[model samples]
Target chain A: MELYDLELSGNCYKVRLLAALAGIDLTLKPVDFLAGDHKRSPVIDLNPWGELPVLVDGGTVLRDSQAILVYLASAYAGHAWWPDAPAAQGDVMQWLSVASNEIHYGPNSARLVDKFGYDLDKATTLQISERILGLIDQHLQSNEWLAMGRPTIAECAVYPYIAVAGEGGIDLTPYQNINQWMARIKALPGYISMPGVA
Target chain B: MELYDLELSGNCYKVRLLAALAGIDLTLKPVDFLAGDHKRSPVIDLNPWGELPVLVDGGTVLRDSQAILVYLASAYAGHAWWPDAPAAQGDVMQWLSVASNEIHYGPNSARLVDKFGYDLDKATTLQISERILGLIDQHLQSNEWLAMGRPTIAECAVYPYIAVAGEGGIDLTPYQNINQWMARIKALPGYISMPGVA
Candidate 1:
């Protein structure tokens, strides 16, 4: 299997992180997102939306980070990351939605815009970040992971952007549980830090 | 099983529609979003994010429309709406994410701000709607369902918002394939219409 990826990108980093965790050896093919390479034909064939972190595994092309994580977990992992129980599954999935829909697109995107020196709606970004971080902090208080009682898909997908959310100008000091959770994630064996960060 | 939902809400409607199709009978409890009732105690217990379409199967309170759909399909269905094939499953999940993050949060939210007389960042909403609608239309032209050659989780979760996106102030008439897709989805037996429509 080959993963079309960009190293600096947190979204691309998600697939790479998951692959490493699940012991899925993937042929990594870097895509030049900055040069409008993802918008071209063959790349578009893999991702019609022409986005990064596209996974190609013989007769299959998959885009979107959360989707890729789900596939990898469902296909390869040994029953630890994805909790198959009914309510527990729902709980894990809810956080994944928050990661992809609320947090990542909110503070993560805002921070990216800041890092890249692009204009962002500052007020909205701050509001989104503050609220999302608050909800996460609240969740982390009673639970070891994003999902209660288990480190499921929720933690796998959401923890990274949250750990780096401070880079987007949102302070994480107030969220003690989140800080602790971040440390726990880093301690996992085979954990690789995202590219370009010391 | 009971579903806490609102009649006119696209997210809430998704839960109802899928349950009906999947042959699961849910006791419907209407949650009044207009009254700010969702933020209150028990409702908050249902979903900390305070969103609509919370499904309670006895003790299990499932939030996030897509998450609820996954639970329903995985738990109750005799057959698969969420295909087991990893690659196709990824594709199914990708569009479901698109429905929540982009389609509902973008165009659907934009249209609601219009109806509720809430302030909106118009330029951003327009940009988001155009991108989402164009992609959905193109996908529809080539694939009969958003699931891509199968009626998977993606279709059950996403079809409602896209079908009514024009009500969100998107001109769906321009996307001929989307128009056709709407007719097909509507033609499905047990199909239900969202509020403010015939």
Candidate 2:
């Protein structure tokens, strides 16, 4: 498998982290994002959305971090990372939606603004981050994992942005449950670390 | 199964439309979204995110439209709407991410701003809509469905927002392929229509 990766992107890191945790060997093909390579041919040909973390496995080419996580979990890790049952799948999927929507627009956008100088409202992004982080903290109060009783793709989908939220000027100090949840994810076997995360 | 729904919400409508097409009987529980019903007890208690289209099926209370679609498709619709294979699931899931992210922020947010008096940048939302719609049109040029050869949850996830993009000041007349794609979805057996769509 070949993973088109950008080291600084949380979305790309998600695929890397999941592959590492699952012990799946993936040849890293780094993209020159700053040089606008992703928006051009090859990358654009693979994913019209011009997004990073495009996975080319045999005959299948997939994009989107959440989708890649689903592909990896289903194809490699078995039910341990992603359940097969309908209810369990739905339960896990809700968090993937949250990751794609709230987490992406919240901490991810905020990070883009602060770390990369992207033109987005920092105040709004921070507010979004706070709102989603609060909800996640509340959700984690009773449950150890985001979905199901065990670690699922939900964790892999949501962990990166929340873990590196400080770079986006969003404080994690107030979210104790979220902090513990991040700790738990780090403790998972074969866990890999990204730049912003400790 | 009971679906907590708001008729005007594209997200909620996605579930209802899918259920109708799948021939699954769903008891609709209307939520007075304008009256802050979704943010109050019952709704808020079921989904802390306070989003609409919550599905209560026996032992499972599922939130998020994409997640609910997954539940319905996996539990009832067989492999027609959502396939069982890993690569196929990934292909379908990529569009679900697009619905949750691009469609939500693009056409959905623009609609919210126009019809519901949401405080958001209309220009940005329309720009997002244009970019995604263009990509969808390009993708649809060669393929009839968003993913695979048949209509999957990808179509269900993306259809509502694009169908009603005009309400958000996004002109859809330019995208012939998207128009044809929408027509194809409407032609599907047991397909249901929502307000603002022909």
Per-candidate TM-score against the hidden true structure = 0.95, 0.99
lDDT by residue for model 2 over A1-198, one digit each (tens)?
Answer: 999999999999999998888888999999999999999989999988898989999999998999999999999987888888999999999999999999999999999999999999888898888899999999999999999978888999999998899899888999999999899999999999899985
Q: Which ten residues in a row are the worst by lDDT in model 2 chain A?
A: A75-84
Q: DockQ for all models, in order?
A: 0.70, 0.91
When just chain B is superposed on the true chain B, each candidate scores a TM-score of 0.92, 0.98
Q: How many angstroms is residue A165 displaced in model 1 relative to the true structure, after the best TM-score fit?
A: 1.7
Can you list the residue pairs that collide in candidate 2?
none
For model 2, residues B1-198, the per-residue Cα lDDT tens digits are: 899999999998899888888898999999998899999999999999998989999989999999999999999989999998899999999999999999999999999899889999898898889899999999999999999899888888999998888788888999999999999999999999889774
Q: Model 1 compared with the native: what TM-score?
A: 0.95
